[model samples]
Target: MLKPLPDTVKGPAMRLQHMVMTFRSALVDRLVAHDPALSRVRMGARVTLSILISIAALIAFHFLVTPLPSISYALAIVLSIEGGVAVRDRTPGEQLKTRLIGCAASLFCISLAALLEGYRLVADLAFLGVILAASLARVYGQRGFAVGMFAFISYFMGAYLKPTFAELPLAALGPLFAVTIGHLVRTFLFPEDWRRDLRAALKAMQGRVMDILVRLSVLSKEGRVTENDRTELRHMEEQLKDVVLMAEGLLPRQVDGTAHSDDDPVTALSMAIFDLHLSAESAIVQSLETPPPFVLVHAVISGDRDLAEKVAASTAVEKGGETARASAQALLWLQRSLQALGRAAGKEAGGLASIDDRVVDEPPTKPDFSWKNPLVRAAAQITIAAGIAMIFGLFLSRERWFWAVLTAFLTFNNTKSRGDAAIRAMQRSVGTALGIIIGLAAATLLAGHTVSTVILASACVFLAFYFLQVSYALLSFFVTIVLCLVYGLIGQLTLDVLLLRVEETMIGAVAGTFVAFVVFPASTRSNVDLALARWYDALGQLLDAARDGESRYRVIELSSRLDAAYRELTVAARPLGSAWSLVTRPGPIRQTLAMFLATSYWARIFAHDFAEAKKPLDPDVLTAIEEARAALSKAAARGSDCFATRKPRPVMAGNAAPAFRQGAAMGADRVANLLNRLYPA
Candidate 1:
């Protein structure tokens, strides 16, 4: 008889179970945290397209070959191709690289699986399980690599398991047809012209500068831009970046042999956009100077010719007079370049005239590149995965081991923490178990009727399609259940056969998942900590630039800090179980660090606004600047301490200013809004 669980043992087991559950919940929360904007829509579309094509291809495969052994191989090829590259809004050529890398890595994984049959204790079933588990662990923290490896292993498993040569072809062909159809659908829906939107975005960036100039003029004259205006400008800048990335995604890669085709308008437009971007950089470098070229343009727009002329003649940026003439020349060249590009592309140009043409020699400072550490970890994970797969195949039956190995490889990505991997393992185990049970039940209920079997298959299709977008695990559940039942219907459906299939599936899934969790656990704490450290560094830079009156550096620094903080915060938020629990959860000090980083950025922006208010050297303005500087110093110190303590800190207040002078005050408020969202306290 089985002994009852001891209270002492049960308590720890239950806690383990609780921790696993909460961890899974956390990851799901983070995945949906970024308001699901374009990503959500794209994922939905992709899943729907994939499922639709998979169904149609399966039907064709059933009719085309009498005893298909080529099917699995074909499916593997298609899935591998699909997995190879993912094009984002930034770089289409990058997609080609991803595809090449993914394919090569997958092929290597498959070869390793084939070689694993030599290992002790890894013979037959266990070998496959170990191989798959190891491959999946490698991809736990990354995206495309895992998927590519999954397709490769899964295809090999299906191909090896076939008793008949005909069945082997059928398995490969089914998936291959599915992916080909999906690719065709995607090509038809998102055409190249979507890239034209990038050119429009570039034009809009110029317009934003002009718009900011107008606001600055009003604020300088009356003292401060409104909070709403600042927020809108920030939003516009974000949109501009998004659009640029999107266009870049649509452009053909040099590898595709279509990078700059004769008919491509995007290439020329992209070139022009890059030039204007340089101009924007130049304008930012001049932002610290009183009566800078942009300021002169603003003054002219406001009907202050005297102020404009006076400001135009002065030639210093950051250091004073030696660089003044160069800065003016740079501004003038920027104006001409903007007009030329705008006229060539039929796009509107703004803020270009304010740039001094001769200022081209001043190079902008570059931001730090600490974001690349995660990639090194990802590479190591993949190498380990290949080794594990080879060892497992050595111990298990080559055929059965393939199935187990493939299942393991799909379990996690390169960036996932060990806790996150544990959560995923549990989900995979449960989902697979349930699918097998349901598959057996469906086979029994619909016994021996062709129409009923077909109907059951169709129902499975609908459910898989419906839930695939919601969650991949759930999608896998239906896909597995339906596949088992349908395969049974075609192969001599019997109660014994159905039960055996279910049992085998559960055995494979569990073995695969367990190995993945145990082999090499991922750790989120370290990654989050690293991100927080970078954020602090960025925060320090922003504060230093503000103190030195380096407006361009401050703005550039602000963007980098925001992006890093958002990326890190997103990673932290996605893996937790409950939204409320994220704030209360212990061990993630990065969350607190992220909050303070945001606060520091806001305080610096406020100080910049206060400095801007002292135009033409009013003694009162310098006094105000000194006061804001002290406030900023305290805020930065508090931010640094909060990261060290992992404790929540109070947010600092904005600079004191009357309602009339609130024009530039709006810029400070916009930063404050972003900070509030980040820290909430």
Candidate 2:
């Protein structure tokens, strides 16, 4: 045996070891958490790499083969970025095809813009025509959108630069080179693999579930759950929802080329995870007098299956009141869910399946081109906004008018309503202002250091793409910094240039928001009402299927649709519950949002419990469920707001018999209370 160390040395060594272990644990947790930020970061890296490689190739060609203009270099950088993003989520072959189409569109637009540059009136008309065509092209889906965007960007570049016909051939090489490099980088460097992504997502979900369980255990030990605890649980629930959606989205792709049985292991695992989440949420909300078995909870946390099963078995024999029994049942469900998770984690597990297989065969609806159609209206609104922006931008700076038009187009790109457009405009304006400030500082510091400026610009490009989905403000900030650095590279960096950008952005954002509000405006209220109606319709279908004892697969299909509808409703209601809405009308929106959330909670619980219920419901309970279903059907037909002013209806007779199962009984009562809240007398 080794000799004992000195006390002082031993103490420091142990402390250092503990620190290392803590750091390792935290790192492991972070890697396993599957935070969406990581995915964005990876995407940013890929795009930045593609840009760098394209630029490098352009430089090499200019030095060795033929002299290329500076405009070619700029075009290469922009096209590389665009091509990388456009090809995301496509197979290698599809990616190549998409790149080719984008390249062709870019070339055609650039050549056309160059040819028309001498005739000012004709060029302006062509610009407007391009905008209209691009807006309409979105109807064809992602591929169309990509091609349209590339064409628009190329036309804008040509119009702004006013390149001569002689320069067209050399400049044409930029897009071709960019597309080739981008395709190679995406296919080899950062190719998408849904199967791998699904596995990672599942692991992240497991980590998230464990985190929730740990937090619940801590809350249970405290003897009572506080409002803060409930709020935290709700936040965690949102995060869990994101992870579940990510996993579900990937499953269909994962199973596409593989053979799968009707009873897919991945589907079963997903159901188990969802059921466990519901059960855990119920335990917390119920605030049972007795907590779940401490030993079982610990065992599950520690991955001690033998210990967990032993504790679960023991808990079945020791129970007290209804709350105690409910707690025990929840623990049992948790155990089963853990087992299913383990099976999925095994390497021998089969491929995943779509959340609802029936949805796959359904034909897509034809696009509506009428005035009342949302897409048509959106296209018209954006085109109008672009026109207004163009007029104002010309007054600001004739050369930079395209910036304002770009901002206006982007403002309405993904917005659903006037409120959303306003919010997006605010975000963009704020982001641009902050970006200018920071970009000014960064550009000044790296003024004469070409390499440093290039490195910083590359970092900004990465960060801009990384936060593309996370925050519009952050994306705009980094993009502005990249622009500032670009200007610095060209020896045009100035406070005046930065300020002009800010002005153009503000003009564009304002124009977009104004048009959204004044033109065929899509109201947030209408969107929310429609979303709620669809959700209620889906919920009614699920409840009807469960009550009628439909096949398990049928019930699962309905439940999946309900889940999808609920997600859509949550997205649609975001503007109503946003900070903007709170600032304008806090009281009514808050109250309505509260009612919506409460109803969602109970509705989910009822769906989960009733679907899993083994025995037929009591006759009186069945009658109550039927009444609730009918009411929901009506709510779907009319609107959720219709129930707001209506008197509450009793779900059951005063002398009705009790429900057969305690869980189902509690769920029914909670749902009844939710309806009462929705339609208070």
What C-alpha lDDT does candidate 2 achieve relative to the native structure? Answer: 0.72
Per-residue lDDT tens digits for candidate 2, residues 89-126, read 35688778878988898898889898998897799779
lDDT values of the candidates?
0.45, 0.72
lDDT: worst 10-residue window of model 2: 648-657
TM-score, every prediction: 0.49, 0.87
lDDT of 1: 0.45
lDDT of 1 by residue, 50-85 (tens): 554565456565577454444343444335324322
